[model samples]
Target: MALTNSQYETIMREYEDRQTASRHLLEERTAEVYARVEGYRGLCESVASLSVSQGRKFLDGDEKALEDLHASLSSLSAQKKYLLRQAGYPDDYLTPVYNCPKCRDTGYVDGSKCHCFKQAIIDLLYEQSGIREQLESENWSTLSYDYYQGDDLQRFQNAVKECKNFIKTFDSDYHNLFFYGTVGTGKSFLSGCIARELIESGHSVIYFSAAGLFETLSRNMFDYKNKDDIVSFHEDLYGCDLLIIDDLGTEYTSNVAVSVFFSLLNQRHLNKKSTIISTNLSLEDLRNRYSDRVFSRITNQYTICKFTGTDIRMLKKRLQNRK
Candidate 1:
């Protein structure tokens, strides 16, 4: 969830690129209008000069000059409006032009967020996530209780109930959850269900594997072209409405990677951002792999949900092989 400094730069650079593209396109259109309005410009200038001269005469007590000035102004206004119509531009378009008329391309309007900024964030998410193919697999409607079966049906049912309750009560202040259990125990299914609901409710969510997070962080740490700084990475992690990190302990446990992981987790805790971390590693293994600091933080900050069940992947593979 933490975006590296290079990633932040990419976001900004994307915004700049979009802005430049829009400006170039608008300039082309404006130039065409200007080319066709040369005659209109000349007429406008002549009318204004005459109006000024007539106004001087009226100031010198000439009543006839005042009448002439008013007539010239009326003629110029009508001609300008007519010319604009002929050019197929709105009458007010010529008054004050804007690339984004709604927000004037400032990314904000009247002290409120602008549609342009919102669009930029969405575009960046789409570009970076690459989750289009997997998104449909996680919808709430696709989840079925029949998928999780065992002597522990009661426990599975309890998890389902808790999940539904969590969705119903979800708000900005809800505590993040860590689903710790064996694989094939429906942790991923429940996490996906939460993702679908949160996304539908208009909250930003990013779901990535723990290994993926480590890989991204490691790459950003060493890559020179990537502009995202450590701070920016931390900011993105905390800024998201919901972050679901799956397979928590699969990453290479280098000293640096472990440190970075704890930093990300700790910051998310402080910010109170909702995170769902699904890990197959037991609590004892977590303590052994990382330090006591991590264990303490996890205990203090997250709601731990223990999952236990048979290996669903092996069962699916066997079934497929049989067929």
Candidate 2:
């Protein structure tokens, strides 16, 4: 499921929009700082003139004049420093600053990666998938089993209890889980709640529908016109704390997509990394859609969670329409 060129362009445009937003924010902050620092403009002009005059005196080979200018420049620098301290400003108060003061929003500092840039990239990638808003709106507190009507209450409660226990003990070494159920069941919600908990705990978690992920990875692998590297997709998937692939078997099944998917899952399993896959497809459907090797790996390294419920979305829709 490769992304169309248009989709890639749209994603890049969204990235550009975020970059523009950061620039505007920085510009506003700079303006605010300029207004806060009294006589800042005059101080800058005076310093510039003194620097120019010092250079001119040096060029004229006048030792006394050069020494005097050096003393003057030092005195000015000290005065600026004292004024900044008096005003409760940092030494870099006059510098063009960014929202991320850590790296000054440069994305990196001193040959090391910056935290803000990493978070920004993660935010942009998540936004590009168009699921950020939907995911953010879901929480465990809102996930109710009451909507799972006409079901065996005892069995449903047991399942919920087990899932809750698993989430509480979730760890990088814990077995990955494959959630199977019909459409509109609570499979995706449970996974989302787990993701939310993990993310809130300071772990990096990437949640993407199977189709969206396949399209993103495939495009990065095939599309060469973009500045983003396919290795980035691989690194994030493999290197992140957790990866959740939802709605598996919904993507256009292809040899390439299957291969990439298999490799990704296999590598993560070998590294003992965790992944949560929720799908409407059963084990038979999974076996038919993917290679036996992939199925075997999943069964061996992952836990299988069965979701039993009616279509919660239909109930919610009906309830909403009544209002």
Candidate 3:
């Protein structure tokens, strides 16, 4: 939710590198064209020299000088483009380029952080959340259904349709997802898919396993010395656009963990922030383990997804061994 000073520096350095690279590329392109296009350099110099003189004359109340400057500059620009094409170069070969043209790689627009900068902050946060690399292979780009068949395939397809709908309407509607089923039934993979899609769309997403989620909560609840880290950590968990808890119910059972979990659900629901939880626990087991209040919050606020399919991982392993 908040970028640390170090992250800000890192993004600035990357922008600096982009600017340097763009400048170097432009210089090289300019030099290459100048060497091949006869009179191109002189034309460029003439345009610059005319701009200064004409600008001064215009300041001195010479309207004719302004008109002449405009015509002369337009003619020179056309000639420059013709010469570049004759020399087999693009007309805009010498134009400045940027990885992000909106801010010209400056990471800011009109003194505000650009969209690219915000996305960069989210990306770094994703890395720190410990799911960046995993998402690369689990997202939409890598979606596959080879391990599914029969009713399982139909169930998976239906569940996927709902997931897609959830993502599609995510901006206009505040909805949470609860994926509950057997282990290795693509529950976690689906969670990653949603996280990846939202993250790429420039929404902030934080992914944590149930154990890690509770562990961080436990630390924040008890660790008074590291007030800064605790505050930031909790803010990220509560304020992120999406928070994913994978393998829920695997965490150590304790009153503190339950209390923390209950509070997290309430705070996120109150804020209208979305949360996704995937667990192997059945509905009855969830109610028994986490208490009725916690279960009630989830059932009321989350769209329950029941995953029923062959264990994709084990199916893949078996298929591999057969091969």
**TM-score, each model?**
0.67, 0.63, 0.70
Number of the top TM-score candidate? 3
Worst 10 residues of 2 by lDDT: 1-10
Per-residue error (Å), model 3, residue 45: 23
Q: What lDDT tens digits, residue by residue, belong to model 1 across residues 1-323?
A: 33345555665575566677777776775566678865776776788789789989989999899888888888888887788788787765455345567876566789865776665655555444445356568666766665456755667777777778777877835687777878788788788788766655546677788888889888877767646455565566667767888898888878888888788787776777778888889999988988778778887777777777677678778889999
Each prediction's total of clashing residue pairs, residues at least 3 apart in sequence or on different chains, is 11, 0, 0
lDDT of the candidates, in the order given: 0.73, 0.71, 0.86
Ranking by lDDT: 3, 1, 2
Clashes of 1: 11
User: How would the candidate models be sorted by TM-score, starting from the highest?
Assistant: 3, 1, 2
Candidate 2 local lDDT, residue 291: 91
The deviation in Å at residue 316 for candidate 1 is 6.8
Off by over 4 Å in 3: 1-105, 110-119
